[model samples]
Target: MKSFLVGIVLGLFAFKCISSLYVKVLKPQSTKTGPERALLVAPGAYIKGEAYEPLGLQIRETCDFQLWVVLLLDFFDNIVNPLQLGEAVNKAIQSLKDEGFTDGSPVFLAGHSLGGTMVAMHGKNHYKDLSGVLLYAAYLTKGNKLSDYPVPVLTLSGDLDGLTRITRIMDTFQELYEDVSSNMKAKYRTPVLVMEGVNHGQFASGKMPSNVAEHDLPPDVTNVTAYQKIARYTCSFISNIASSSALSQQVLDEGFNTTFRLLEPLARVKALETNGFSHWTELAQKYIIELQNKTQISVRGIEENGQMIKFEFLFPKAEVHNSAVAITTYSLVTYPLDPFDVTLNPLSPIQIQAKMLSQERAKHVLPNGRYGAGNITCKDINQLSILEAFQNSSDVARERFSKRGRQIYLDEDQIVESSVQWQATQLRLSDGSDGLHVSSIKYKLPFDPIQESKSGLFYCALLSPFRAMEWIYVDSMRLKS
Candidate 1:
């Protein structure tokens, strides 16, 4: 009887303990008995005498969703080599795996600044178990290598950070993307996003700076006012590639009737500006106008005629002497329409045929999330079926995610853009937070004219947190056109 009583009490105590882990620590499913689900790595950028313990605790708390540890690199005292930093992350991950903490839940490798750079260069390749990697304010000193990482990488940067040249880093990523595409000979690539308004220090919520506007935050925009907004978007992004439902309802609404018009060809894609926004709408308008004015193409004009909807495009008459019918048709399809309606069916036979041809062209080119193709080529212009371009990097970024696999977030568009023969590089707007404003700017066209002409499309993707802040203009002309 005494033994039975003791056993019952012990069992109850164990149950209580399990309840605490789930209810308090694990929260959602502490009752399930299995290996610990996830792990988190912290940034040890300035870990010195007074900073170590508190920052370590901060990181552990930040990553409470999964089992986590802080890697105390001597970066503060001795600027460690990136390779060494990579190895340290590997060791820590291995330790967790050794402790039998490996289950189906994800193992996250995350870091800040230099630490973020380390993960991008080494984490997924060295630590195979990492499910997802979140890099905050990190630059790729060396471009990302290892094509078969089996992990998703989420790279976040601030619009106005000077410490890490975000634009240069983005350019480097494009180079890496090109290198990877050439080596793998693969059609698709991973995704990278430059989150606007986020500075380098805000990845963890508690340590946000006071001066900055609550909404205009770096990653740490987790004050009371922004918590709900922050958590919803952050969690959804982190949980997994967003469900189609999670996408902006407005964007999705616009997409229902629209088909995809891939920007570049197989293995040869163009650099897409994932972070540009504010001026993209205007640029789209300008491109449409140019197509209508400059080329003998059937450019559409969308307007609502009260109850009746009107979608009109003027096509060059099929006079054999004027131009080849196919050329004229192709020109019309590539031309952008003003205030285009995705739902409206093509009106004229020429428009219908152009739309069909555009759809067929899209089947061959790859898709990178952007609102409209900028600086497009004859080959790329000829190929697209859909006329629309993605508005946000996330649109393209999510496409590269892997399901039930190691790699979670990736977009290889940058890499493919590099291999093209006619590559163009332009100085872009810098976010204001960096304190260094671009009061003046300059870039000579034919950015990389010689090598870029071969592959058909030649363009550069300008990655800046403040890319959407202003109109991108050269001395006289707008850059997007």
Candidate 2:
């Protein structure tokens, strides 16, 4: 027992020494001449900054942002001299300036995990001098305001990150996502992206033995693919931030166009990968509750008891605030399904029950359809067609909204809402890791479903703020007698 105890202590001491030594041995990157823009990258606790080389390399391929990898020795430095990390900010800026980067030149700060926290904390004092912030798998601590959000902030996180879960990232910036659309002036004010099938440590290229603490790891997506997507989103955000209004649109168009070109080949591979109908269907059912976009939207089970429709949606995970499943039920005769034409009108618009539910309350959803997790105020609304819900949607959004998403048969004039009373209870996410388990979601109790039109119904997609890269749609659902 004495020997075992000595061995454990010796092992810990050796690890502590070895970690510090690793940071010292890393060589600093040589400066590039006449760099267009500057980006200073920092690493998490106990992580070497060089681990982000692959991501930086990918980012530089598209954007002109010069990468200045900070040699932040967190494991030892954080323990012995934490203030050194903070002091390095001014030094890093001066270093950039010395390397021919001017005061007017676009300069950005980026950090991952704990390093991100430190960079965010720096915002309370020096955010006015910076152009923007790139936080990966991390969120700003409460009470830290970054230039009243004038600094274009992009928080890119992984959906499967266990150390810092995606839900926490959403909750941390719930205020930003929930704010009225008009008030959101700076397009890049807050765009929180959750990459599918990515884990916490995956953000950094080098995999170290230290990553064992990360939980709920991804079952799919290689690190290379994840980094490629990450770099693409990062590049787009940086380029847009640096561009003028007209130029920004061009940048977005190019980025989206690039994604469109890859979809054809990705679709072919996806088809081959998911060969069996049974396998695809099983994945589809699970995705509906998970907020993925699918080809069809099928309710796991739907019951029509009087005016109230109760659904057996599985469940949601634990988060800083709450979780919800957004269901788009479409009543349709349906046209040919096209992958490239998603933004186009799928068919006819579906009408919602006269009363109120999630969609009707919040007329225009955020870009990613995020109306932050909470009770959608249910009010007594007159018979409203799905088209009316998007009354405030932008011209671009309207093009899609006009004929997109919604599908439910039965005429809007045929709803027969006379003497109708409205009642709405927000759909809730139950507690714990039991998200895979089933739960009841009751949101409306007033408008009756057109009984005769039930069979022709084709639900569109189940979107959750916790969305994956792939979309999941329910092809169809059965009517309960």
Candidate 3:
């Protein structure tokens, strides 16, 4: 027992010596140019600043910003207490100032995961001189108040990040937005970009944890592609901040709009990748055909009048009825080119209006097995309700539904073959056209089957829920003019 104790003590001492040597030998280095803006990046736990060398180089190549990579002492010290890491970063920043980094130029702080949280904490104290804060897969600790920070913040996270829950981050962002003063909110819009299908570690092109399997990690584009996307957004945000003349109300509004416009394509592509549609052509024919067949609408043509493109489709009439209950549904699905093909003209309008002719026939059955015709009206599905449903569904299930048009049955429902009547539904584009690439189909409940339980037709309605028409596969050439 005495010998074992000595061996354990010797092992710990050796590890400490090795770690101290590594820190001294591989201290963080700065990519110094005579650029006005400076970016100080803090690395995550058990990670060295060298891991982010490629990303740093990419950012510098794209923008006129100096990059400073700050190395912390060791993994244990940084993880157990981030204050030491923060102090090391402060020292690095001070060194850069001494090396002719002028106060006239702005400084931006950025980090990934735990490093992100560290910078957020550090920025709260050093907010006066910071142009902005950029966080990738940021994990917030208890009592961390992002609302107190005065600088603009841009947080990027992946949906498949096993380490951090995106919903919680979204909640925190909302709270921060609400807690800020109206004036501050106007100046610094706290934008959170949640990249679909990206995992926690992929944000940085570094050695990932060995315990995580490659297949279990979120699907990503090539490493170069992923880093390029991140770098572009980071450079754009910092550039906007450095170039802005004032935080006046009008300037703030314009700045926010411009920022979102630049970010729209990046967000759209990320969503498309998440839904298993990586390239533009892969999403072209199948997706367009699915929408047409599901809605039972034939595309008339696409008319381009200057900057606006008008799409016209024909909506056919249909009737559905049962002994005690009947319902008629009408819908139209539209697919525009912007979200799928970002290279297209940015001047394209976000939404194109569609005109649909709707008709409904509803009937109620009597207790004596007699059909009773009743007047019924079709109403649009609530947008909030659809959003709630999407949020409630699992990520994998949602991706399958989006990519393959597969329907997800409720947990209580048995996995037996089921049939549902197809209906014509209209697709409305929301304000933000970020995720509008996917086809949107809607079905209206013509009658409340639950209310008609006394009529003995409840089981029949329940078995066959409302759905779009069965799609018939057609040659891709048929869709062309």
Candidate 4:
């Protein structure tokens, strides 16, 4: 009986030794194909390349794309030693390049969870070589810089993913979208797809995390169905990038409508929306207009109702003391007159002025766990008059305004055109104790504005508590006479 017990203990030890050796020395295999485009996939931590076999097969069957599953150092090492894992990814990519997957064809980097973060970090360095990046349930550090990466980025996250909240993912997306350079705007547009009712573990099809508490399971769709939809979008994104064409919004929207049942949470949307601007679409439109006006790029034409002439005036970027929680205001004011009168006399001069204001607030938690808040009004104000020009006008005018200390500078006086009552529409948001505010005045002139046709004005102001105040504005108005 003693000999038999000793033998059993020895057998268990031997099995453990062999398993450790297998995990430590295991290397990922390379799959070769003659396809023009190839997808290099990185697996999540503790998950082997075999776990992604089902996803890879789906990609092959549906899109006919080549797949390469990258392996890292063992699971234990990955959590502790990120550098070693990074080296493995680099070696795998280099091998793929040597094996006829040259830069001539598009190479896309894809990953799930930890794999997603690794590919993003790698793609930052190899952005020029890779066509695009796809991240699934990936981890994004707070204040992660997305502007440095120039290539197109596509992020997929589950709405109910507890590990990586959908709010954080969308916030990251907004940061990336805002940081896109003017030169790359035409070719690349970053789009995010949030799968409703899914969770973190479902991104991987075969093996799910044994600890269910860490995941947010979808009540409607099975894991298999979720993976199928993921594969479809992933393939479509890769195809679009390979063609060097802009991603098709129609295709993505259609897939989203068919696969996902819900939009982002209402509470998340409400947090970003200002009073009266209750819908996310309204905020999105405002940002879209601002981008178009700032970049001086207009892809769509304005509707002509044959009666009222309509155009947009864009203000400069505003500096917020609290970027995480701040209100954005966009106001449009138009002259009150007979629509026929302005149409008849197309050469009316417009005047523009800008002002800045500050406000403070205090809040405390009550004994009942409720909250109390109040605002402290400020008496400080600064104003400046901005110059304007019109198209077809030979004598173009330019003026510069500079402020020193608390002294405000006005290069020109306020020109009162016809006593024209203007209609004003504004979108504003206010939060916390301290905030900076700006107000602008604009008027139409007889001469055309000094910019390309269909261009608008953009103004930005910097009001910092620790530094001197700076006012900047960009006027790209080309008024038609």
Best by the TM-score measure: 3
Tens-digit per-residue lDDT, 296-414, candidate 1: 22322221122111112322121122321111121111112424211011111111111111211221222221224344422222122112211222332223211111111111222
Error of 3 at 55 (Å): 1.3
Query: TM per model?
Result: 0.36, 0.45, 0.46, 0.44
Candidate 4 stretches with Cα past 4 Å from truth are: 1-35, 64-81, 94-104, 145-147, 176-188, 210-213, 245-249, 253-269, 272-481
Going through the candidates in the order shown, the clash numbers are 37, 18, 7, 21
Query: Please, what's the RMSD in Å of model 3?
Result: 15.7
| lDDT over C-alpha atoms for residue 268 of model 1 | 18
Instruction: Specify the poorest-scoring 10-residue window by lDDT in model 3.
Output: 469-478
Q: Candidate 1: lDDT over CA atoms? A: 0.32
lDDT of each: 0.32, 0.42, 0.42, 0.41
Candidate 2, 1-481: lDDT as tens digits? 9999999998887555444432212112344343456666777766667777776666665444454443444445433123454445556666656655556777777788777776666654566777788888777655544326557777777645655653345444444534424554333455566665566777776654344243324324787887787877776776667764455445444533332332222232223112212222223223322333332222222212222332222111111112233332311111224343111121111112111123222222212333334322211111121122234222422343233322322211111122121123221212122121111122332212353112211122211211111111100110111
TM-score of 1: 0.36
Worst 10-residue lDDT window for candidate 4 reads 357-366
User: What's the residue-level lDDT of 405 in candidate 1?
Assistant: 11
